[model samples]
Target: MMRSHRLFLIAMVAILATVLFRVPAKADYYGEPAELVDRATSVYKGFLADPNLEWFRNNVGSARGILIVPQMLRGGFIIGGSGGRGLLVAQDAATNKWSSPAFYSMGSVSVGFQIGADVSEIILLIMTDRGLDAMLSTDYKIGADVAIAAGPIGGSAKAQTADILAFGRSQGAYGGVSLEGAAISPLVDWNARYYGQPVQIFDILINQKWNNRQADSLRQLLPKPRRNAQPLGR
Candidate 1:
């Protein structure tokens, strides 16, 4: 009996060791910085141009920027798991150009027996003046710096619009359960250097540099924000 107990203890220790050294899941962004920039630019620029979304985009420069982390980032288990990553770019009050984007990643772990994978998108709203101020600091915690809300889906057109106005996300899945309480935190790259780049999301919409053909394609797709909110006034 004592021998059996000793063997059980050894097995348990081995299992715990495996879990401790578990490999991190890898994600594929397709090695496409241009694609990410283009997609993010479209989202930001589209929000700006849309008559409906302009007020929010205009305010984002002053509003705390949001970080959205997809749940179940890369896949693994050993190789089966879930989580996501996000980034934010803010404009300087004086420069009027985007600062190097602040990148962040968010995720969680579980103890229950579960497996499989899913895709999720995190949308964040930077709602308060203080929240924005906190993000600009060297590093910020998710709950510490910004208020977090776990978003839900489906509603009337007006309700949907209101939901979009706040932070929200869409999740897709496979397996026994879907995880929740999706949270986020800032990603720090100490070696990276950031300078304000002259690029503006506005440039994507109206810049004449694009051939008339491309310019028209972009303009037709991007509409000016309807609310026309001014910068936060003193």
Candidate 2:
């Protein structure tokens, strides 16, 4: 009897170890910085090509910064959560040039009558300096720290004045989508690996401390700011 009990415990331990090893880590979702940049470029190009997002193209010239989450997943049986990795780039007011990309992660959770899952590609346009400043912190809640509104679609949304505008292309069967309490934070491990050193979000987007040549394609896709445009402010 003693021998049988010991054998059972060992088998359980071994099975647990195998299960742990099979599961991928958070770092796996980040991929390489170059690969992420390429994906971001593709996402942006797809937005431009979509006729429903023509308002985005028209108003992009006035944006202070843009954050692109190539893919975000949300699902639940009863309780629910959503999360994804993304990159953000700021535009220089004087030169109208985009800075190096800074990586971030966004997540939200809810408990209600919800089921199934959905995947979405989200783009956030920082329309004011206040919105950009909020993102520079270590972390913040979307609607709590800063304001965000659903971007108007098609060509009819002409005069938007929100601090931040969000647009998403979602596919899958989900009850509904809500990002009101979503938290946005810097992806520290991913950023360190991408830059090959520990760096701050401001260093990448504000100070221009490092540059990756692979991001050239993404930089080119950013819309040029209107000439002599004043910086975004209240």
User: How many Å off is the CA of 50 in candidate 2?
Assistant: 0.9
Candidate 2 wrongly placed segments (more than 4 Å): 1-28, 172-178, 228-233
Highest lDDT against the true fold, candidate: 2
CA lDDT, candidate 2, residue 76: 60
The residue-by-residue lDDT of candidate 1 on 1-234, one tens digit each, is: 999999998997776555444423333242333333344445444334444433344444443234433323533333334454555544333334333344455555555544444454444544445545554454454555344433222221221111112432235221112333334444333112122233332232122121223123222432232244443311
Question: Model 1, stretches more than 4 Å misplaced?
Answer: 27-64, 70-84, 91-100, 107-119, 157-185, 190-225, 228-234
Q: How many clashes would you count in candidate 1?
A: 19
TM-score of each: 0.47, 0.83
lDDT of 2 by residue, 1-234 (tens): 999999998996775454333222332365687777788898888878877777787778888899988777776644566778889999876677789898998887778756566678788889888898988989888877667787877666555566788888876221113467888999888788888889888888887887877788898888897775553334
**Can you list the residue pairs that collide in candidate 2?**
none
